[model samples]
Target: MNQSSTPQVPFWAHLLCGWPLFLVAVGGAVGGGLGGLAYGISISIFKTNVPMPVKIIAPVFIGMAAVVLYFVIAVAIFTAIQ
Candidate 1:
């Protein structure tokens, strides 16, 4: 087929290839930051006994888990669409 006449890859192809990774990276960063912020605020406001490192690390780990969950969901949806 001529290059111009060839069918372009569907939008979903790009989404399937890239969107989950992007979302996870973004979600992890956001979740980590928010988690740290919330921990800091709670510690200052409520005087929680949790350690600073735990507060900072918990969110990052949770965020990573969330990203994995998100990927699974996305894959399911993508499969259904196909």
Candidate 2:
């Protein structure tokens, strides 16, 4: 077997960077999922019982709130862990 002449990267560097990056990625995914879930719930809740303006506006606000909440929570958790 012939060995390539390219330099090898250190494992510690990969570990140090990889874990946090992985966590951040997972956090973002979870956050987006939770936001979508909140949007769905908000849609169900606002479908028939609210005023037209409220029906149009409340879910958007709710989804935004959910996304912000998720982002904050995820960052907090990631920071805490690291």
Candidate 3:
């Protein structure tokens, strides 16, 4: 018995080549997951241990960063596959 030699598909091949709508959903999930994680960590960790000014500003900045991160990651994934 013999087997034909074909290059193995990369693990991410489907992710990079699947339906466009599916990719968008995946990207949004990943970005939202990470962004929410970051925000949660910031709120939990910096809630009470920080100085007054830091307490007021850190969460806001972290939240903004999370939003930016979400958008950036989503855009990057969508663009990369394009």
Candidates 1 and 3 compared: the better one by TM-score is: 3
Among these predictions, the greatest TM-score belongs to: 2
The sequence of per-residue lDDT tens digits that candidate 1 reaches over residues 1-82 is 5466433544443333232244534446654444444433433332334665664455445445556666676678779999
Ranking by TM-score: 2, 3, 1
Superposed model 3: Cα runs more than 4 Å off = 1-28
lDDT of 3 by residue, 1-42 (tens): 876564343434322222232323545676556555655555
lDDT of each: 0.47, 0.55, 0.53
Q: What does the lDDT read for residue 42 in candidate 3?
A: 51
lDDT of 2 at 67: 57
TM-score of each: 0.42, 0.54, 0.52
Pairs with backbone N, CA or C atoms under 3 Å apart (clashes), candidate 2: none
Candidate 1: clashing pairs of residues? none
Between 2 and 3, whose TM-score is larger?
A: 2
